[model samples]
Target: MDDILKLVEEYIKEKDSKKTWVAGEDWVQYAGPYFTHEEYVRAVKTLLNGWLVLGAEANKFETKFPPLLGKELGLFVNSGSSANLLMLLALTSKRGRNLPKGTKVITPVAGFPTTINPIFQIGFEPVFVDIELDTLNLDLDAVEKACQEHPDAKVITFAHVLGNPPNMDRLMEIVKKYDLILLEDCCDALGSTYDGKKLGSFGEMASCSFYPAHHITTGEGGFVAVKDEQTERIVRSFREWGRGCYCIGKQNLLEKGSCGTRFNCWIPSLPDHVFDHKYVYEEIGYNMKPIELQASLGLVQMEKLEEIGLKRRENYRSLFKAFSKYPEFFHLHTAQPKSDPDWFAFPVTIKDGAPFKRSDICQFFESKMIQTRPYFAGNIMLQPAYEGLHDKDEVISKFPIAHKVTTDTFFLGTSPVINKEKTDYIEYILDCFVAAIRI
Candidate 1:
């Protein structure tokens, strides 16, 4: 087994060595996973261990992940979408100070569906607010206005767009003034910080993605991290099928149990003095737990978090410099002075009177095999699925910026996979395309 494992590791390394980032006709992916040979080996080892469910690897990843984002606890889930759902559901748990049904949640109009879907899924009214064109984040001024109009709003949930931190100073003020529960979707802003503190750490709870296109890859995985023990327990309950059991893995330990109630816990509704904790259902939840294999891969990917962040920042800067020369034709994504963003992609918005449209440039890029994608579901409210989900009165502010985003904004590859050759190709294509438009 040892010899075979060594050979497998060597094979992975050889395969990795053959990969390169030279510019060519092949597709330049908008996003791709960065995995070292070690990650492959760890995955194989976990597979051999046969603990396929959310076991030791999941526990270790959950335990070690919180500190990276300056949080107290982590709950692994199948995807970032599930993490978002779990986080929202936890806040509505019967065990916690549940926000009453139909409570208003303040969210941005321009964002991915999952960010706001969970609010509606969990029976909360979503009050949409506009985004700032420059930062591609919630315009806090608009957010404050919406909050004032809807004084009953009880929660604020939003994403750090393309890993660019929002105006944390003003956002925190609004959060405090309204006394709202804050949940940051840190899926894109994994390593981003506002005022020197991590974005995820600022919110009461946060969600992170481990998808291939995100900062890290576990094939398909994510986590919901919290700052308090009780919240952690609630999140854990939701991720693990709403079980009352707080045991790490199972309730088979000889000593007191993981939660100190292994064999001793009374149920008010039950006739039994001490029912098994594993079977206790505390709240309505779902089976969203991730497997050990995904956790094993995530553990290895976690080791490169800082390195990936640095590379992403480097790529973003180079892309920014390249695009800055075309300010008249583009609206480049911006970061506040207090923000330290590890950008996920280099977003470009065609100016209102630009000779070309987003489709024009994106089509040209696609023809050259340089991938581009629209901002994820720009103006999610405009999406067909939302036809009847919201009331007309729920929109307190106009989504002019969001409407512009849907038509003007698109993003290019700034992933670590983009090397100098690819960047040069990108710049060359942009120059040619712009010159053509000028003609």
Candidate 2:
């Protein structure tokens, strides 16, 4: 093991540590895999211990993730999507403040599918609201309208889209006024702040993804942060095979029948501690726990979060500066007032009269090997997934602003891995695109 570790260390050191910028690279990805030799070693160590499941490492991540979001009670899950699933599941648990079936959840029509998928999967109706063009986040007015239209709305699940927080202060006020449970999807907005408060901390429950593209990478891990103790308990129960027992790990199983009396049992008239932990199910739950190896990687990645934030900020600023020069060609997105965005990607919109279509520009960038992505499922309501789900025939008409964004908006990579050379190359491509279309 020691010899293998040494070889791994040597290999990492021997590799060219300098960052590279290849021209015409297939759309500079939204994020790249980042890790140090130590991170790999920690993962290897966890494997060597023969403890691959959720354990101490998972516990550590769960404990620490909350502070990053300015909250308490972090529960690690298999992926960000799973974290969303668990968050919704917790709300549905009977032990929790059960949101009755068909209860409506107000969400943006422009968000990632997973954010709204759980609401449907949990048998709840989603009240789709439009997003503001400037922030690419939920339009507060539209949200209020949606709530007023649907008084039965039980929750508001909003995402800090692309790391730019919405008007959280106002949104929180609305949530409180309507007595709605606020679930912030911070999957793309970790480290972002609104009015000096972290994005995830404002909601009743918040979720994050540790996918490679996020502020930090854990390969495939995510966490749910809860504000109240009841929510926390429900989240744990949902994650832990719906087991009612809150005890940590294998110790809970051993201490069951070890009381003073030999035949003593915790449950009335039952065998002395013979209850099967695996069979002990309470709330409807799924196995969404993340492995220790992913947690170990998370620990290392967490340490470098501040540095990553800086790089992302710098890259975003550089791209903005480059794109801002041609407002006629593109409509640049802005953060909400008092928002300190840890930009996940630099978003832009092709002007309605611009000589080029979104597809043309995207193809141009692709040909240059620079990657581009549409603003997550542009106007998600337009997708076939929600076609039959909603009552409205023209969902975009309901959310006119979001529809505008869907038609004109797209995003460019501002990931930490993108350096000056890549940014310049991207700028050159954009300039060429504009010239070609103008002619």
| Leading candidate by lDDT | 1
The best candidate in terms of TM-score: 1
List the candidates' TM-scores in order: 0.96, 0.93
lDDT of 2: 0.82
Q: Mind giving the per-residue lDDT tens digits that candidate 2 earns over 254-305?
A: 6452222322343445655655443556686677888888988898899988
Score candidate 2 by TM-score against the native: 0.93
Question: For candidate 2, which ten residues in a row score worst on lDDT?
Answer: 257-266
Clashing residue pairs in candidate 2, if any?
Answer: 24-368, 24-369, 25-369, 27-369, 27-370, 27-371, 28-371
Lowest summed-lDDT stretch of 10 residues in model 1?
389-398
